[model samples]
Target: MSDATSLLTVLVTSPRLPAGLMSRDAWTALEAAERVLASDLEDPLPAAIEVSGITVTALPYDSPAEAARALVDATRSGSVLWVGSPDADPGLTDALAEELTRLDEPPQIEVLVGSWDLPGARLLDAVAVMDALRSPGGCPWDAEQTHESLAKYLLEEAHETVEAIETGDTEHVAEELGDVLLQVLFHARIAADEDPGFDIDDVAGALVEKLIRRHPHVFGDGDASTPDEVERSWEQIKATEKADRDEDDLLAGIPVSLSPLLIAEKVLTRAARRDIQLTYDDKADLGTRLLALVAEARAAGTSADAALRAVLRQIARPATD
Candidate 1:
């Protein structure tokens, strides 16, 4: 077999494109091929290529080995085997390689990437999925959910994400983070249905704006050399952003929706940062003792909320078992 007869070119491409969306190089390869082959005849891509005046032959072989054998035979005549979207069909390439290596004159394989997925494109897919779930004639549970109803899930997912990170399991962390992202998408979708509503784009836009506004050192001329300086800048920026709200008390913005332990810790931490000394009565009850313990935990650089959660988990495990 001569060098011209020993060649096989596999064109890998995304199946999501229309006829004109394909690259010029991909069109050229398809037009120039002596024999174009695809695993699935029913796929729109083969018919689309045929519309451009290229004959695409769907391989009649049932197995990968059989297809490989046919490809080897076709390439023996020095014909170009234009494999359509081989990336979509796994194990086919390996089978072709196995059959090709067995022959004394193997075809030189070429893998062509005709198209690529854009960065963060999957996020659009997630938003679409959420919108579909909440649309009319969609999931009843999802359609009925409101921001108020989904509040618990948002809190739960955030805690689960933190727990996953603490476990140091990358897979679990990714799964939990995806769950958190779903909550964001779900809320945005719900909001989109309301009067004067906003979608995921609005949510993303607001977030981008907030990040840029807070990160003056990176995005602006502000110079924050240390982590502490950056944090101080962030707090100052946040305070200015919230200045329009009528919040006279320093702890007025602290969320009452948080758990008692968390609220206690946050209040104590804020007081400490502001140099506000809190005094507890010695004759006070268990509640005062617990508050004092939270202050002590803060002073020792430990999370009172986390400490309580650990104890609660220990107590709950036995009952769950």
Candidate 2:
């Protein structure tokens, strides 16, 4: 599993201020939480919090965070973190000045059971986590990828993001979007490696500028009502901004590599713009034509799509046919 899912960030906000105090129950919860957390106990603590049922580890060791690390581990194991007045003596607070060195996982993380959830995301910072993937000292496969080679993956990730939204899975959509973002970051990293000027920030800034420049309706004085009008305005602005390019015809925009069905659809769509109509309002006519096509395809040993393509091809290039 990816670290994102496994990593948690639990924040136990106390109703009271952070006066180095916690309720007994909260301390107990923290101890329970520690069992599940993975700890990197490298440091000492500024204080030694002592509770009847729960124990805040001793202080004044090598690192300052030793006590917190123990608590983190304990909290992960289901220890409850206390936010209110702590039962432990105030002396522990100053003594528990343990260094909060980062941990990928905690053997135990003490969190208040009913208190704010201690999310796992903050255990490791972004740079520290992604360092292994994007570093010169990281994975060779990841380091070798380039913008062009990763384009298809970016597209696929975007498609998955769209699917996730359409299906109304916000969390899944978030995850998929993250995948897309990773691809983007990966590409940007490659671009930076290839040309020192193009980093992730540059890419983001360029897009932001493009959006503002194109959206005179939203960001400027141009008037556009509905989404369709906004889209029309956007297209016009984009066209105005874009430089002239070589084109044999308006139809040249459609790539030849599209499947025949899609190509036929596109060609016919363009024809419709020129005032051609292909309509079948009658339900009986629709059913009869569909059945006829299926039967004809069976007889010809071809799919309905293929047969439809053949017909569209004749109509599309009538003079050549």
The number of the candidate with the highest lDDT is: 1
Which residue segments of model 2 deviate by more than 4 Å?
A: 1-132, 246-321
How many residue pairs clash in each candidate at the backbone level? 1, 85
Evaluate model 2: give its lDDT.
Answer: 0.50
| Stretches of candidate 1 exceeding 4 Å from the true structure | 1-5, 13-87, 94-104, 114-121, 131-141, 166-170, 280-285, 315-321
Best model per TM-score: 1
lDDT of 2 at 211: 88
- Local distance difference test, per candidate? 0.78, 0.50
Give the lDDT of residue 89 in candidate 2. Answer: 29
Candidate 1 residue pairs that clash: 5-78
Please give the range of 10 consecutive residues that has the lowest summed lDDT in model 2: 37-46
* Model 1 vs. true fold: TM: 0.72
lDDT, residue 268, model 2: 47
- For each candidate in turn, the TM-score is 0.72, 0.45
TM-score of 2: 0.45
